[model samples]
Target: GRGFYSPSDATKWVAYESEPAQLLTIGLGVGLFAGGLGVMLGAPGVFLAFGITAASLVFLQFGVAVPVSHHIALPAAIAAAASGSVIWGGLVGVACAFVGEFMARTFLCHGDTHIDPPAAAITVMTTVVNAAAAFGFFALAKLPA
Candidate 1:
């Protein structure tokens, strides 16, 4: 009950009205679409890395902001909790993949040192994506349905 809203709290009225399932489904659809776009754009097979990075971001957010929609049914609440991450992660994955591809061609082409520029690029991009997702999620979650 640590994250649960009190039964008498007025804030929970919004949680009951929010459409969490729709939000989650939208995120999933967007993510898959973005993946397809990445493939078409000739990203350098970074889907696995992208997924891992996204998952990490989602996990971190879950830890930091553990919101509980106690008014909603269990399944719906879970979906709502999950949708934020899925949507954000997918967007980040696609954006990072595109940027990583560009970095690979631009700065990573130099084979002078042992540093893998592509990996570094992905790492930096992931950090930015995570930060963006965190802020975006916080803002979006606070908005009324």
Candidate 2:
């Protein structure tokens, strides 16, 4: 009798699949909260504020990985920073929606199959979450403290 062969998993694949969901959840929460504080404080809060902004922006960008890359006349570092802030922050809702859809298709079904109903629901939920975070920041900024 022969035994079935099991293939060894690669580092990236193992890491990607094994990565804790809590990490992403916590990262998003912390990023939004810190970023909100940064925006509210202004000037002096630049480090933590922009740092959170940059992290969230990158997370959203990686989540979507949209194809279009536009160039501006600003200096290289500034242009990259501005692009990340404007594009990612501006589109976080939509990007998260897409990510939700992708996650549903990949995880819930355990196959490549896509169900429109669930995908739409997930997208809407993601959009709401992103929008809430954005508006929450705006609201927090208005408070005097």
List of clashing residue pairs for candidate 2: none
TM-score of 2: 0.24
| lDDT, candidate 2, 33-53, per-residue tens | 433443444333434444443
Runs in model 2 with CA error above 4 Å? 1-10, 13-20, 49-145
Summarize candidate 1's per-residue lDDT along 28-75 as a digit string, tens digits.
Answer: 443444434333332332344234334444654555432221111111
Q: lDDT of all predictions, in order shown?
A: 0.37, 0.33
Clashing pairs in 1: none
TM-score of each: 0.35, 0.24
Scored against the true structure, residue 54 in model 2 reaches a CA lDDT of 42
Question: How well does model 2 score by local distance difference test?
Answer: 0.33
- What lDDT does candidate 1 reach at residue 61? 58
